[model samples]
Target: MVRRMFLPFYSKDRGPPRIRMQVMGTKGRRFYKIVAANQRDPRDGKHMEVLGSYVPIPGSSASSVAELRLRFSRVKFWLAANASMSLSISRLLGSAGLIPLPPPLFGWRCRGRYHELLQQQQQQHLLRESELRNFFKLPSPISTQLVERETEKPKKEDVRKIVR
Candidate 1:
């Protein structure tokens, strides 16, 4: 039997896209990832707006760029919409003569990511370590004794007759 519908619980939304970015960075290094939000929502009309975006050009090599002059006006458009660049992205932009290098954002945001990653790593490590400890306790482990080798005299017959 179908349950009675509640208008408050089921509301259809026809609106703009929801998008955001997930960035990983340290004081001097930053990596960025873009994610589209609300795409999975049934009420979403189309692909959601980007939460964040990044310029993925490898920062180390300038010669890799094919053109001597290029425009990143599209990326700038996203920036104008309040999108932020990853540290690596900022560095790349600076190297490409786009924008000035940004200072380290070492407030709660930077620390918060570090703290979350650290906690996750610690939990994973503990889980693996416990699994290993449990696995070693299984049956069929053979015991062995440790002892030093005893010296033995060489037999004359076994030695070389030439004496060289």
Candidate 2:
């Protein structure tokens, strides 16, 4: 069985080139590649496999417009193996009806990506809260002032009065 690997901060530091569809070639020529590689590897480094190819600029007149040289079967296999495509690739495939539009990053994988995103969001929220606290000299979120009076324990005398 193929093990599912989760590299935390892989997308953050190295970016999503490996698991993503990349646009290659110089200015005059451009092509797309669906590949899977290690995050730390170079752009042209070792890849698991070349799932498919998309030639956006087919310079040759002999070739039909928008020629897509793809291994349709391999595409499905890679996707099943937990590989994800870039936004552009998703859009391209969506247009071709191969895959759905607005494809998600880290599709159908475990909660690793989601947890990372949540941590990032939480950090940002904490940072914003700290900034607000510093500016306003307000107490921490867990402070007494922030606690609801209704939820607080009633004093013994108050409880006795209620009982009476």
Candidate 3:
């Protein structure tokens, strides 16, 4: 008789495989392992393979630029394999340029609201300017000229003369 190792077989009904981080390390000092796992599994539970690691806080003596290290080839393979990535993992991958960033919350609705707010601000600014002009009893042309003069940048020749 021959002994053989068999991999755990998960059915489609169990849910799609997921790529996520598994928290490790002690309190205060934290470490994370990027892994390919089953969606039904617990956060730090059994995983199929480790894709890479993320160290949020490196050791004091370490001089490396980035704290995160990933195997891009393996990650790409898993992504192509139809594995769904967790939100946090997706954001990290997106920042690394491996994947497109998720759509902004509320999308076009936010842009429309921002434009409305900008219009309201402009209206308020105009109203305030008109009130200031009335209160100071300044002519429109004079006020406009004064604003232009204040906004104009001094020429290099003028700056040199001032410096001298």
Candidate 4:
């Protein structure tokens, strides 16, 4: 079946790459991204690698449903198998004749069924952090001045000579 996959982002010291949704390509047990047909093949589509990210140009765009549908035959085998698609990659699917094209996706939304689970996980993380803080018993972050208060009374000086 189609197991939807998310295209996570990666960043380096020099630059960063955009998110790319990928899935096990039907061609030959390879992982490839749903890319524009106009672009070069990512490879033989054998190994799991990015084909390319779907880039939407500003103002006007180049990719169209027609261009995408032309490549549908290549992807039909996978679609029949119900190969999973990523949330961000829906446009490609629509273009390729799987689902109807919708608005551009800025990010991926995991199977909505897990929203409660995600919330629980976040709450658990917060609780663990609080527990750690309480266990450590660390003082406040701000520094305070230490003042010395003298309370002991001074002894009276002996006026009489010592009887040695």
For each candidate in the order shown, give its overall lDDT on alpha carbons.
Answer: 0.46, 0.61, 0.73, 0.43
List residue ranges in candidate 1 displaced over 4 A: 1-71, 103-164
lDDT of 3: 0.73
CA RMSD of each candidate after superposition: 21.9, 19.2, 22.5, 22.7
Ranking by TM-score: 3, 2, 4, 1
Task: Give the winner by TM-score.
Answer: 3
User: TM-score per candidate, in order?
Assistant: 0.25, 0.42, 0.52, 0.26
| Residue range 1-164, candidate 3, lDDT tens digits | 21122123333655556899999999877889999888888889888889999876455632232567899998997787677887778867875669975543476447776676457556766777888888989777223321334578889999999999
Error of 3 at 116 (Å): 19
True lDDT of residue 158, candidate 1: 69
Residue 41 alpha-carbon offset, candidate 3, angstroms: 1.7
lDDT of 4 by residue, 22-57 (tens): 444455343334532212223233223334433333
lDDT by residue (54-121, candidate 1, tens digit) is 43345655223322222466445445444444465555556465676554456734666667645755
Query: How much is the lDDT of residue 56 in candidate 4?
Result: 39
**Candidate of highest lDDT:** 3
TM-score attained by model 1:
0.25
TM-score of 2: 0.42
Better of 2 and 4 by TM-score: 2
